[model samples]
Structure formats: structure tokens, C-alpha cells
Target: MGQGEPGDLTGRAFPLGDWGRPAERLDELYRWVERGALETAAWYLADRTGKRRGARVLRGGAAAGAVAGAALPLLDMTGVVGGVAPWGYLALLLGVACVAADRYFGVTSGWMRDVATAQAVQRRLQVLQFDWASESVREVLGPAEGTAGEAAERCLLVLRRFSEDVTELVRAETADWMVEFRTGSAPLGIQAGGVAGGRAAEGAVVPGRLGVPPGGTRPNMPRQRPPEAR
Candidate 1:
């Protein structure tokens, strides 16, 4: 579909007629989606539907406030111009109260939106971690016989260590967001640790020689014995 047009059920083009072309319709759809329309839609579809009712009630309260607000000025003007409307001032007060109540409810909805966004992000990260761990494990241990399984196990151990490290990093980030939301402050910096010693030791081993550095000037000369002759 073109920009701004709402797509049909299969995301095909659907012209919205003189309602400002397909592109405008699509833009409106995206605007609604970003503004919690999907969650609101689900709430409407639920059997219990208490949240939907509550939202309707809040909206009705806001509408009542808006109507009262509009009427208050006219009532005040009439009163000042020698019109005998004793309840005009009271109406103005009620309108102000309604507007304040509407604002409070709006803030509540905003907080709920933040929570929903956080939960969605958490689910996405969990799926990513699962896939990464599974693939890394398979890659490290998917060949050879008997002893090969042991090597794979070692690899998995190292992978889990790294995964845990990465998970801590993610948790720190999540915590930072929470802290910022609650206190309006940034989190302190964290220190980095050295690599795991096991992996470092494994890197030191070389084929046909123990504890030999690659491309170093060490004089290692005896490598003639076959397995049977050794």
C-alpha cells in the first residue's frame, strides 16, 4: 500500500476515498497503533472488559469537563453583565475539577503504556538470548566421537559464562531505565572484568607443542615420532 493508506486485511491497497488518499489513511493507522490502539482494541475484545469500561468512564468524565469548561466562560460573562445566574461560578469550578481529573487519568494511561512497552522489550530479549545460546552450543559441540562430547561440554560451559555476562549487562540496562523513570537520574558506570582464565589457557595450547607461543623464536626441533613409534 502507498504511504498513508490503510491496508486491507491482507495489507493490500484500500483507497479511503476523499478522506485524503491511501497514504493519509495508512498514516492514521500507524498513529493509532503507536497511541496504544492495539492494546485498547484488545481490552474492548476481552470478555471481562472492565478496563474498557473504566477507560470509557474516564473519557466521559473528560467530555463532561470539556462541556462544562466551554459553558463556564459564557456563564461568567453573563453574570458580570448584570445577568442573574447564581450557579455560573459553581459551574466554572466544576469544569476546572473535571479537567484536572481527566489529566490524572491520562497520566495513569501513560504509565500503563510504559509498562506494556517494557514487557514487550523483555520478551524480545528473552527470545534473542534463547536463540543465541542454542546456536552457540550447537556450533561448539556438534562433531567428533566420545571425547568430542567432553570438548562440547567445555565449550558449553564457556558459552554459559559469556551468556551470563551478557545477561548481566542487559539487566543493568533495564535497571538503568527503571532508575531513571523513578528518580530522574542516570545510572553510575560499571567496570569491565578480564576474560575467563580457562579460555585464555586454551588459547595458549598449540598443535604438536605444549605452552608454545605462535610465531615466537623458541627453538623446538624434535617432531619425528609417529603415534606407534612414540
Candidate 2:
């Protein structure tokens, strides 16, 4: 990395007001992890509630258009809607529009990305908690390792590392999402009727595509920032 800006993940400050206070270190770590996890979870819910519905609706629309297009031609055999010629074209257009909308919005890809990010964050949170426990054990087993200040710094190091890891994960996810929005990522196809796009919209549910995931928020507690490493 060249000169890091304040906005750069590694350079950002996580001010820990009471980080050095012996009584508040545990609380501070808890606060830091919870806040990061909360934002990540909110994204998961937003996509579950919003974008997911839109994807489903678009897919349903494409299906409906396909049905109408198929039927209209048969109906034309029986002389319906003046002739199937115009009606068939309209149905075909509807399918294309729905498919195109699905691809352009990227709702399907978005939810998958959010879910993956949320799961990744959860795994890290688990690792942080376990690390805290491991460190506590080490402290008990060998408190004579160094001075009190050194011990506090050790705790600070743990907190700092956890905070940085979470920050980097979230920042990377958000950046990729923004870039995807600014410049589209057309899949293997964007041809007539957007057959590829329609497949993409429906692809989320296609079993092997998404893989396993993560969950469950911790209880409510007063928030605190992770200790800033000196």
C-alpha cells in the first residue's frame, strides 16, 4: 500500500476511550465485535426483505411472459386477439424486459454477496471470541511473562487485530459491491431476450451455487470501541 489515507482500512482509528482501564477492556472488545456484526446482519436482512422479493417477482414475470407467448401462438391458430402475430411479439417483449431488468439490477448476485459477507464476519467473530478466551488462559497460566503495561498491550494487540480484520472484510465487500454497481459484470451472455440474465436471477436457488452460511446475533449490551494499538 502506498501512503495510507484516513479512509484506508488499516489507517483508520478506532478510538478506545477506556481501553487502558483494567475494568473496561472486556466490555470494549464486546462492543467492537457486536457493532461490526450488527451492520453486517442488517445487510443480510435488507436483502432478504427487499432485493430477494424483487428477484422473485422478476423471475415470475419472465415465466408468465413465456407462458403467454406460448399460448398466444396456439390461440392464433384459433384466431384470437385479431392474430397471434402482434400478441406474441408483446409477450416476447415482456419476457425480454423482465429478464433485462433482472440482470441490470443484480439483485440475485447482491443477496448472495451479502450472505457470504455476513457469514464470513460471523466466522471471524467466532475466532475473536475464541482468541479472547485463549489469551485469558495464557494470562492465567503465565502472568509473569512481562510488566502490567505489557499485559495491557497484549490485550490491546488482540483487540486491534480483531478490529482490523473485521474492518478489512467489510470494506472489501462494500468496495466490490460499489464497483459492481458502477460498472456492470455481464455474465457469459447478454444476448437476445437475456436468457443468460434470467438464468442468473434464478441461479441463487440452484443448489450447488451458494454453499453453506452463518447466523444468530449476540445479546444487547453497551457499545465500546476496540482499543487502538499504540
Candidate 3:
């Protein structure tokens, strides 16, 4: 881990400094991709889990509210609980409000999109690793039409390009998430034309809901073409 050293990545030592030594750089590049992909997966998994729970809570609250409202009128009409219908209606309103808030704030949609993105990224990493292994074998067994170093350089180019693509995609996702946090809107997967005219774009992030922001609240980045699968 010293400066200029790729360090003991796994069991192999990646040589640093030597453009003539693209094999080591290629290995290091793969390592970077693996590390970034794993980190990305973990972070989004946490996010997905948290938001999923929030979504369940919201759905339950809404259902409960609806039941209370419907049964209150019947209970009051039956005279078993006279004059309780108003309270029942109020409770229902509260429940509906909670659900509405959840939808508008994009709690459910955010989790789904992020989880999907995480899975996709993880799959890409797996493919990249597989390809790297295949290329390594090829380099070993294939005729030396090009020098080993030349082959390594080609591998570096491919790996670096793929790595950049992944990084940009993840970064774009984060930027969108930040905007959602600030603006309190979901990514259209949650609320698509059923209620509020498909515009659930208002709310503040509660503390401990996502992560604690600096000032404790904001609901909610940019558009980017999704990366192509390699």
C-alpha cells in the first residue's frame, strides 16, 4: 500500500511504474474494478434494504387506514360505536397521507432502481473478471504474433475503458440519488400515472431514513445513457 506500489493485491504483487509493463497495470486495473464493484454493491444493498422497509411500512399504514375508515362507518351505523365515524375518517386520512407522502418522496421506487442498478453492476464485474481470466489464458497459449507486453497493453486499454464506464454509470446514479434526496421525488418507477398525475415530486428526507445529511434534511442529479453490457 505504499506510494507508487500496487501493493499485495490478493496474493499477487502488481508492479507499478513502467508503461512497458502493462501486464501489471492490467492486473491492477482489474483489481480496481473488482473493489469498486463490490463497494457499490454493498452500499446500494443497504439503501435498498432500508427503503424496502420504509415502503412496507407505508403500505401497511395505508391499508390500516383504509380498513379503519370503512369499518368505522359500519361500526357507527350499527350503534355499537356511535359517533366514531368522524374519527375513523380522520385516521383514514392520516393513513392515506402517509402513503401519499411515501409515493411522492419515491421511497419505494428509489430502492427498486438502486437495487436493480446494483445487481446489474455486480453482473458486469463478474463478466469482466471472467473475460480477464480468458484473456490471460489466451496470452499464455496463443502464438506470439504480438509481444506479451503488446498484448498486455491491449488488455489494459479494454479494462480501463470498461472500468471508466462502470464508474461513470455509478456516479450518475449517485448524482440522481442526491437530487432525489434534495427534491423528494422518485424515479418514476413508483408513481407512474395512478395518482397525483404521475408527479410525486415533493418531500424532505427524514433523519435516519437514508443517511443523516449535514443539516438533517433535503429531498432531493443528471441524465446519462446507461452503460452497455460488455
Candidate 4:
């Protein structure tokens, strides 16, 4: 879409002069996601058609060759003694060849599946990044006065959540649990956890923290309150 008006949702403009580096980094991440998706789809298609077709052809050829070889033995084994025996030998050879070919080609399916899954994970991460970028832009345009600190806070919150979601997505896809989140690439060095104690007090809500107005709570949502006396 056209980067709409400066403050328009469609435009979602950031201070290009300041956010240029981070913006570029974000774009790079998006590209990676898109590429990964394409690669995954390719792997899937090859696994489904190319690999299976190759295996089928190889198996059929091996079977035919085996039957021919076995026929000669069978003839020799009959009164010629070479007939039936040769046929049996040929059949055994063909069976082994077919099995071996299938085993070799079968590997492609698993490998492609793994590659597809990895790409899917990357795509999920990209989606999270896109959402974070959009949300950050909207927050900046909210009623709250946009300042460096406010922008930073908004960025930090979004980054923190995005990182967590990505980490979880990776773990889910790979079945290996690990939590690793980086913030260097994020705008304003916004990380999941709060800033260091020495740098700023914990939970210190800066004025810039107020980006968008807090939307009205849902009517059915339960409001968390302090525990009452027993």
C-alpha cells in the first residue's frame, strides 16, 4: 500500500531520519519471512510429486528386470536345470533392489518436511513483526503526545511481546524448548524485560509511555482487584 499520509493509518510513517536503520532491519526480516515461505512451499511440492514419482519409476524398473532374470533360472532348473532356479534368483534380486530404491528415495519426504516447517516458523515470526510495526505506528498516532521516550516505551512493549511469540513459535515447530530474544535489531533498543536498574527505576511509566488512549474495557471482561478478606 502507499505509505499513506504522514499520520494516516495507511501511511504509518515513522521518523525516517531517526528510524531509518531499524526500519531497514525490519524490512530485511520481512523479506526473510517471505522467502522462507516460498522455499517451504517448493520443498512440499517436490516431496509430494518429484520424489515419489522417481521412486515409483525406479521400483517398477527393478521389478521388471528381476522378473526377466528369474525366468532364465527357471528354464535352466526345469529339465534344463537352469530354468526355475534362475527365475527364483532374479526375483530375489529384484525385491532387494526395489526395497533399496524405496529406502533411498523415502528420505526426501522427511527432509523436505523439516525444511517446510522451518520456513513456516520464519513466516510466523514475520507476521508477528508486521503486527508489532503496525501497532507501534498506531500508538504513536494516539491521543498521547508522541515523544522519544513514549515511542521507545511503545516499541519496547511491542518488541517484548513479539520476541516472546516468535520464540514460542520456533519452539513449537522444532519441539525444542528454548527462550532466546534479542533486542539490538529492535527500534530504540526495546527489549522484553525492563531497562537495567541502574539506568532507570523499574515500572517507571514515563510520560512518553502514554501513546494511545486506553480503549474501554470489555463489558464481559473481569476486572482484576485485590483479594478480599477471608
Q: Which candidate is the best by TM-score?
A: 3
- Candidate that would win on lDDT: 3
Give the lDDT of residue 226 in candidate 2.
Answer: 97
For model 3, name the residue pairs that clash: 179-220, 180-220, 181-219, 181-220, 182-219, 182-220, 183-219, 183-220, 184-219, 184-220
lDDT of candidate 1 at residue 110, scale 0 to 100 = 31
Cα RMSD for candidate 3?
12.5
Q: Which stretches of candidate 4 lie over 4 Å from their true place?
A: 1-29, 36-50, 59-85, 104-230
**Model 1 lDDT tens row, 80-104:** 5344244545555665665555444
* Candidate 2 global CA lDDT score: 0.54
Which regions of candidate 2 are displaced past 4 Å? 1-20, 74-82, 144-147, 186-230
- Flag the better candidate by lDDT, 2 or 4: 2
| Total clashes in model 3, counting residue pairs 3 or more apart in sequence or in different chains | 10
Regarding TM-score, does 1 or 2 come out ahead? 2
lDDT-based ranking: 3, 2, 4, 1
* TM-score against native, each model: 0.30, 0.63, 0.67, 0.35
Which digits, one per residue and each the tens of the lDDT, describe model 2 over residues 1-230?
11122323322134367645763766565566556555554545544456678779888988888888888888877875557767876987898889888777776666655566556656666776787787677777877568767876777776656555554444444445544565554221111111111111111111111111212111238989999999
lDDT of each structure? Answer: 0.37, 0.54, 0.57, 0.40
State the number of backbone clashes in model 1.
10
Candidate ranking under TM-score, highest first, comes to 3, 2, 4, 1
